[model samples]
Target: MHDEGEPGDPDNKSVNSDPEVQQTLEVVFEEGDIRRRKSSLVPSTAPRPDHRRRKTQCFVHTLLEKHDGVASEDLNASYEGLAQERRVDKDPHSHAEQSQHSRLLTKKQISDMAFGIRELSKKLAQIKIMLHVRNIFILAKAHDETLIKHTRETTDWLLTKDESYRVYVEQTLEKNRLFDADGLLEKNPNYRGRLRFWTNELAAEKPQNFDIVLALGGDGTVLYASWLFQRIVPPVLAFSLGSLGFLTKFDYEQYPQTLSRAFTEGITVSLRLRFEATIMRSQDRENASRDLVEELIGEESEDHHTHRPDGTHNILNEVVVDRGPNPTMSSIELFGDDEHFTTVQADGVCISTPTGSTAYNLAAGGSLCHPDNPVILVTAICAHTLSFRPIILPDTIVLRAGVPYDARTSSWASFDGRERVELNPGDYVTISASRFPFPSVLPLDRKSKDWIDSISRTLHWNGRERQKSFKEWGS
Candidate 1:
C-alpha cells in the first residue's frame, strides 16, 4: 500500500528508516502545533543554521537547515560571517563582485552565471545608467535601415524618448506593410505591426540631458553621428545592420534583449578609440584673389573649404589627401612625434586609430590595430615611391598634408568615412588624435578580435579552405 503521508506522520517508515538517515532527520514538533514541525536535518555536530522558506520561485533548491523559528545566536553568527569573512579578490571583474555575495567560484562558473543573467540584467541596469549619463544620446543615419529595423524589434519604452520614430512607426502601422530592399513583407495580422526605426541624432538634440547614446547603423552611420557629438560623445553601441560590418559587432536579431540590458539593465560598457582631424585652409596672402582666380577657371571651392577659417575640427579616422576619382600622383607631407622620425611621403597619407586601422587603413594597406592601444596608423593611399610604408605612431604626433597649386583636387581629408573638408590647391590638412573619443558598449562575449572575426564572417573577408577533414564539414 502506497500511503501519501503528509510531511510528518506520527508513524512514518521512511524518516527513521536508515540509522544514518534517522540521525540526520531529526523532527522537532512545535510545542503547540503538531501539524507544523521544523525539519531537523542538521546534526548536533553540524554548524547548519535555520533557514526560512522564501518565495519558491527564487530557486528549486532544498535548503539544508532548520526551517522557520530562527535562533537569535545562529542568525547573528551567520550575519557576522557574511559581513566579515566575505571579500572579493582583486581582478579584472572585481567590479562584478562589488554588489554580489563573495563566494569561492571558478572562472567557468562565473562566466556561466554571467551568461545566464545577462539578458535580464541589461534591462534592469539601463534605467539607472541612462539617468547617470543623462546627456547621452542615440543617433541613426538615413542609410542604416537594418539597425533601425531591429532597434524597434526587441525593446520596450524606446519610443518614450524618440517621438519622431514613434510618428514614423504610426505611419508604418497605417500603411500596414513593409518596403525593404528585397521587397515588401506579406501583409497579414502577423506582419501588421513590427519594428520601429530611429536615428542617432536624437542624442545630439538635447545633448546635456541624456546619459547614454547609440548610433544605430553601419560604420558610416556611426561615423557621421559620432562627428555630430564632437568632443561631447556619450557611450555608443554600434548596432550594425549591414553586410560590411567592421566597427559594429552587435547583431540585429538580438537587439531588443541586448538593447534593454545595455540601456536599461546595465550589463556592460565599452570604450572605443577615436581619431580626430583638423582641416586647415591655405594661408596664402592671395587667398581671396586665388578663390576668385579659381572661380574664373570654373572651379568652385565652396564645399571644399569652410568659411569660418579656423580649420575643421579633429577627425576620428585617417587624415587623407589623395586623388578623388582622378588617378594622379600626390606628394603628401608627413610628421613624426619628434622631427627625427619625420619626413616620409607617398601617393597620400592615412592616420588612423587602432579601431580605424581596420577600415580605410586596411583597404589602403595599413596594419590592423588592437583597440586598447593608443596608437595611430599612417599609410599611403598608393605610393609611387618604394620608400613609403605604413607607419605606427603614438597618438601624440600631428600629421599634415598640403596640396600645391599643381596638385589640385589630388588630395583630400576624411574622418572615419564622414567626408571632412577636402584638400585642394593651397589647402593643408592636419591630422591628430582628437581630445574626444567614442565610448562604445561591448557584450561580455565580445572584444576587438571578435570584431575582426565578425567582419571576416559577414563580408567573407578571408575565407579559408577547410583545413579539417571533409567528413567533419558538409555532413
Candidate 2:
C-alpha cells in the first residue's frame, strides 16, 4: 500500500502547489463528498481507502487547472460526463473490483456535489447583479421654481454621493430649461454623461428599466409617476412639497436622511392598487342589423362588431362616467363580472381603487377603505333614486358600464380625471384590477400610520369643538 505522502496521493506536496486549486479542493472535500462519506462509511462493511479515490480527485483538480478559463456551468457538465463514463466503462467479469471502484462516490455524494455547484452558481449570479449601476428616474411637479431648485440640489447630492448611479429626468423639463443641463454640467463636469433625459415614448417602452423613481412635489407628482409607468412600476419615494401630502409623506427637509436610508438600507414598500380601464367601441349605429341588446351582448357582425380602442390606461385614482354638458340625467347599464347587475340612472358613476378611496369616491360619499385592502369602490353621482347608495366590491371582479342605445344623450368617461373619451350609445368601458401594483416607499417612521395621519391632518377627520364644562357655563 502507498503511503499518504506518496506521489499519487491527494496529500502530496505537488498536488497542493496552487493556492486556488488547493482552496477549491478543500471546499469540495469539506462540504461535499469526502466529509459525508467518511462519517457514513462503517469499518467492517465499508470498502477501505484506496489509490482509485485519490486518483479520481487528482483528475478533478487537473481538469480544473487545465480549463481555468471555462465557465462554471461547463465545468459541472464535464464532471457529470466523467461520472457517466465511469459507470459505463466498468468491468463485468471483475464484480468485486467494479463494486469497490464505484463505491468511492455513493448517490448521496453525487447529489451533494450538484447542490454545491448550484450554491456557487447562485453566488456568482448575485455578484453579477451587484456589478450593474443603478438607474433612477425623477418625476416632479411641472413649472415650480422652488421644487425645481430642490430637485437640482437632490441631483447634485446624488452625483456627489455615488458615481455609478445614472439620473434621468423628463424631456419636457430639459427642453423648457427648467432643469438646466448645461449649467449643471458646467458646475460638475464629471456628471456630464451621467445626467440624461427620458421622453414619454421611451418611458412607455422600457418602464421596468429604471431601478427606482423619485417624486418631488405632492400627491399629483406621485400620480404622474404612476401614469408614466403603465406596467412594472419601479419603487417610488415621494417628498411632500405640494398642497396635498397624502401620498407624499416624507418631508423635503429630511431628504438627505431619507434618501441615504433608501440607498444604504432599502425602504419598506406598500404595494398600492391600480385599475386597468379599456374602452370598447361598437360599429356604426346607422348600419347595424342587430338590436341594442344583441350588440351590447357581443353579437359580432360587420356593422355591429365591438372593437377595443388602441390602448388601455392604468389609473391610480378613479374612472368616472358622467353626463357631459347635458341637462338630463344619464342612463347607464352596469355589469359585474359579465352579468348585468343594475341600471344606474344618475349624473354619473365612479369606479375607484382602495388607494383612491379618499379622492373622488370619498367626495361622492363612498366608504373610506384602507389602502392595503383588496377592494374596489363604486359610487354613484347624484342618483335619481333615493335608495341608491355607494357599494364596495372585491378587486377580483370586472365591471363594465355602457350607455343604452335608446338613451337621450351620450356619456363621457374619464380615467383618473384625465383622457376624457365620449362613450357612444353602444360603447362600453371595462374596469378591472391591474396585475402591476404601484410600489411606494414609506417614510422611516411610517407605514399604515401615515395614512391615518394624512386623514386626520389633511381632512381634519372627526374634528369638533368640545362641550363646555358645567362649572364654566355657570360662571
Candidate 3:
C-alpha cells in the first residue's frame, strides 16, 4: 500500500504496516474534511482558519496553555469558543492596510480645513484697516498771493504723501477753475483722485460731515472757518501764513512731519470759548428816557439808516459798539446779569472773550488773559472819564450794553471786525456764552511751552532794551 510516510524507506514501511499509523492517518483525514465543510458554510469574506488560529493564540489560547493540569480537550474547546466570539465581535474584512489608508485621508482633510480658516482670517483683518481712515476738509485764505501759493503747495504735498486722505475745498473758489482765483480747489491737473470741493450754500443746505478742518492761512482764516460751521466746528489745524499769526503758529515747512504725527499719534486740542451777541430796540423809547435824553430828543434821525436788529451774531473775538460817523463820544450803559454795572463814556465799548484779550482788547489797555481763562473782558475805547477802566468779569454772568433811551447819538455794533449794524436810541445788545465752542488743534509740544513761545516768537512779548545793563548805566 502507498502509505502517507517517507517514501521507499524501511522505517516508513514498518510504520505503515503498524495499526497505530493507519489509525492516525484516518483521524487526520477526517478532521481535514470537517474543516473544509465548515469553511464552505461561512461567507467568502469570513476570517480564514489560519487567521482564526493566529487570533486565538494571541490571548486565551496562550494563557490557558501556560497553566499546568489543563487537558488538551479543554484547551481545544476554549480555543474554538474564543476564536468564534472574536470573529463575531469585529468586522471580518477589516485589515491593517485599509485602516492605515483611512487615517491618512482624515489627516489630510483636517490640514486643508485649518489652512482655509487661516486665509479667511487674514482677509477680514485687511478689510477692517481699509475702513478706519477719516476725511479731511481744507480751508485756505483768499486774495493773498503768498497765502494762496503756500496753501496750494501744502495741498500738493499732502496728496503726494498720503493717498488715504479725502480732501475738500470751498466751492466758491473752485468755481473759477483757477487755483489762484480766491484760492479755490479747481480742476487742476495736479490734483489727485481724492480731491473735491464744497460750497457754503451746500454746507448750509446739508450739514458737512468732515473729521478735521485744515486752515492754511492766518488766524483770521481759521476764525472764518469757525463761522462757516455754525452748528459744529471740527478740530482745526491752523498754519501761519498771515501777519500776527498768534493763533496760527504752525509752520508750513514742518507740516509733513507734524501732520504725520497728528494722524498716527493723535493731536493736542484746546477748546476755545465762543459768545453770542443780540441787539434789540427798547419797547418804550421817549417815555423811558431817564438819562442823556436832551441830545437824542432834538436830533433828526434818517429813516433809511433805521432797521430792526433781530438775529444773534456769534463772536470769537470781541463785539465793538462804537461812535459810527458821530462826532461825539458814545454814551454806553453796561449791565451784568440785569444789574446796573456801569456807564462807559468813551469812543467805544468792547466786550471780548479770553481768546480776544490778545486782539483789540490788548490795544485798548485791557488785561492779557490766558486763553484757558473762563472770563469776559470789558474795555472802554479811549474813555472820556478817568475812573472808567477795563474790567474782567466771570463768564457765567450775562452782559447787556445799550444807549440809554437818552443817549446823545447812535452807535455802531460790529462783530469780529465785520457785520456792522446801527444801534438807534433805546437800543440794547445782550451777550452770553455760547453752547458751541471752537476746538483748536495744538502742537504736540504745547504742554511744555504753555503759549509762551508763541508770544515770544510772534508778538515779541518782552522785546526791549535789557533795562540798560546796570554796569553800562553809569558808563
Cα lDDT of candidate 2 equals 0.68
Worst 10 residues of 2 by lDDT: 24-33
RMSD of 2: 20.5
Candidate 3 per-residue lDDT, tens place, 1-475, comes to: 0122212223211122223223111101122212345646867697766633343546656665443686555345454344322211111134423521111112223223224323332232222111122456778865666665665666666666666565666655554434553332354444545676777864444333565678987878877876776545666788777787878858877888877776665555566677767676544434443442222222322121222336566678889999989999998977764256877888999999888888899999998887777778999999998888789987655676778766789998988888899987767676766544566777755533656777788779989877664655664
Best by lDDT, which number?
2
Q: List the residue pairs that clash in candidate 3.
A: 171-198, 292-406
Candidates' lDDT values, in order? 0.47, 0.68, 0.61
The TM-score of predicted model 1 comes to 0.53
In model 2, which regions exceed 4 Å deviation?
A: 1-133, 175-178, 285-304, 466-475
RMSD to the hidden true structure, all candidates: 22.8, 20.5, 40.1
TM-score winner: 2
List, residue by residue over 49-119, the lDDT tens digit for candidate 2: 67442334575565555345876544454554554333211122335233322112233332343343234
| Candidate closer to the true structure by lDDT (higher is better), 1 or 3 | 3
Model 3: how far is 274 from its true place, Å? 1.1
